[model samples]
Target chain A: MKVNEVPQDGNNFKGSDKVKKLVYAVDKDGKYTGVNTKGWEAESFATQQAWAAVEEDLKETEQQVKEGVLSPIAYFMQKCLMDLPLLAKHVGKWQWQVKRHMKPLVFNGLPAKTLQKYADAFEVSVEELKSFGK
Target chain B: MNSTNYQHCQHAHCESGVTSNLLKYAGMDISEPLAFGIGAGIFFGHLPFVKVSGTPGTTFRTWPGTIFKQVTKTLGVKVHTQSFKSVDKAMQALDDVLATGKPVGMLSSVYYLPYLPDAFRFHFNSHNLIAYGKQNGEYLISDPVMEEVSTIKPEDLIKARFAKGFPEPKGFMYYVNEVPPTVDFEYAIKKGIKKTCFMILSPPIPWFGNNAIFLLAKKVKDYPKKLTPRKAALYLGNIIRMQEEIGTGGAGFRFLYAAFLQEAADILQKQELREFAEELTQIGDNWRNFAYSAARLMKDRKSDLVSFDELSDMLYNIGTEEKQFFERLKQVKW
Candidate 1:
């Protein structure tokens, strides 16, 4: 793309206005040169779509928790942008064990030690983990 | 940490920019394109089995940390690299390195980097940044993607460095200790091009290299038939995000490599490389076009939006063009 043709169709970029990408565009002399771009509409839409999917997933999980079909651990895990396997790795628990913890009966009956580990992995305090959805 | 003694260079990609700026700090004048090309940074892979951020993984460059290692080695620059199991020790090591007036390059997760705009922060763990000094308890950062130097808190730095995910950063850090006075541009550039060709052309699996592009094209063509529109759009969006978002120097590092070729042509006086540069730039433009259409298709669900087959055909063409492009690039005479 030419320097003059570089895409400046800025989107709703959060940090993009302050820091633009140094894109390589052909200069007026038909030579490659670095040109900063605030944002590109195509890329920005792609990003928004990804985040929207995440939020939608989180909302579904939030509903499941409210319905008492799932535990707070399940909600918190998605909230942290983690699935069972990733959260399992962080808390040093087996995949099956983490899956088991997604049950309200299992999660609520857990000891302080296990809850602490889950809280630590989620970057939240034990009290916060306990009081989730309250 | 002496921030004044160092000059940070802004570039199209993060790792190459960091590599060039770090080399510059060591008194070795290297442009971002030169470092990127010499490091053989340009690459393409689409692995549907492998998932990054819950989407099928697609990479436009060599894995993180490879560019720095490859560029430094080709230039015969001595460097020290280390990864830590301890967070405190990692933070201390950074401060100690900065105290010696040397900037430290470390891998960090974008999600924990508060200095970046909210839109850009993700769970990506391979983002590179330089810590030149500490002031008032914040580590001064020279993130290559940023317009200006930024700073980070030690706590946030720890969170970023230790973010749990696939291919964790593990507090990885490296810095240049010495740079050779002279470099053979001919050998380095040829070696880089040869390796790039070999990597893109020689991958045995269908999920990688030129074959992966075809595979991705087939998948794109199938997305609507085999999945819900929402899920299909999500998959397509991930592909676009990989191609355009997070800076592969636009069009999945094609333009960056074209820029490299232009520079290489000037350095080695190879007129053929200039032509190749133009070809690759147009190919890069094609990829951008694919992204543009794909994003629109994703944003709108109507039949009037670009069809899945049209998008697939675009990718298939890109794959064919790149296959031939690299085949000729592989045969470039020194």
Candidate 2:
């Protein structure tokens, strides 16, 4: 790639702030040098698409929670990419107990100590975890 | 070592760029590609069993620290590396190292770094950068993946260094302790190429080297039937992001390797290696084409998206092409 050809359209970068990548460029002497290339249209586009897919899943999870079909734990576990075993490890709980806590009735009956454990594992406050995305 | 003597040059990959820049600062003239090639940085692996962020992990380069370790060892340089359990201790150690006029190389998480754009922030823990100096409460950072030098608050720097996740950095840091007066570039170049070829061609498991490419292709083909539409799209999107978005320089580090071969050709005066470099450049372009197609499919959700079969076929073709290239590369006499 040539220095003159570096992408300058920073608008394609998602979020309010602009992102730049260090790109390799060839000069008149065929020598390679690093140049700051701004705006990754393809990367931003793919990421947006991926995040949209994630949002769709989140919406479905919210609906399920609202309907009492599942508990907030299920939504958070999915969002954090933590399986039962992983979340269990973080919270120092058995996998079976973690799975049981996914039920709305069971989770609601849990003590504040258990709720604190789940909240700490997810890096959220107890209140936040109890009413996630509300 | 004068802090002013350290010149930061941007590169496609971070670790290799940091290694190259450190070498240059230590009075050894080395290019990023040369550092990458001699470091044996190019690699591939797709471990479906090892999940990263809910998706199978696909890597285009060797794990972090390999490049710097391998390159310095190959060039007869002495380096000191350490990881700390305590954040305060790590900060003190880093400051002490900088106080000696030597810049410290550090492993950090990208998510906590404030300089990177919000869109690019992820929980990747293996990102490499250099701490050249300190002023007030800030650490002057020479992040190879960025264009300009940036500074990080001490609190943020410590947080990045101690980011909790898989492959936790644990405040890992390294710096060169000794540099030889001269290096045997010819020998290092040949060794690097041979190692890369052998690793890619000869990994025993199906989930590694050239085999992993085919393995991933097969899994992708099954994804449409095995996964929901949304899950399938997310999987495809992650693959593209890993290949094109993060630190690949573009085309999954193929172009960087080609640049290394070009440099090797100049160093050894090998016409065949130059030709091979040009051929590799075309292969890199082919990889870019694949990313473009995959991205297009990902973005076009309304229309009939590109079939998983088509995407799988594209990966298979790339794997085959890469296999042949490395096989020939291994045979070239340096």
Which structure among the candidates has the greatest DockQ? 1
Evaluate chain B of model 2: give its TM-score. Answer: 0.97
DockQ of each: 0.75, 0.41
Model 2 residue-pair collision total? 0
| Model 2 chain B worst lDDT run, 10 consecutive residues | B298-307
Give TM-scores of chain A for all candidates: 0.92, 0.77
**CAPRI quality band, candidate 2:** acceptable
Write the residue-wise lDDT of candidate 2 on B1-334 in tens digits: 2266668777778899899988888889999899999999898899888877667888899878899998999899999999999999999999898988898899998878988876667678899999998977788999988778899999899878987667889999999988999899999999999889988999999987989999988998998799876677777778878887787776778878888988999899998887787677667767666776777776674445666788889899999989999999998865
Interface RMSD score of each model: 1.4, 2.9
Candidate 2 Cα misplacement greater than 4 A, ranges: A1-9, A12-17, A25-33, A60-134, B1-5, B302-306
Comparing only chain B with the true structure, the TM-scores of all models are 0.98, 0.97
Candidate 1: where is the Cα deviation over 4 Å?
Answer: none
The Cα local distance difference test for each model comes to 0.88, 0.81
> C-alpha displacement of B57 in model 1, angstroms?
0.8
Error of 1 at B123 (Å): 1.3
Clashes of 1: 1
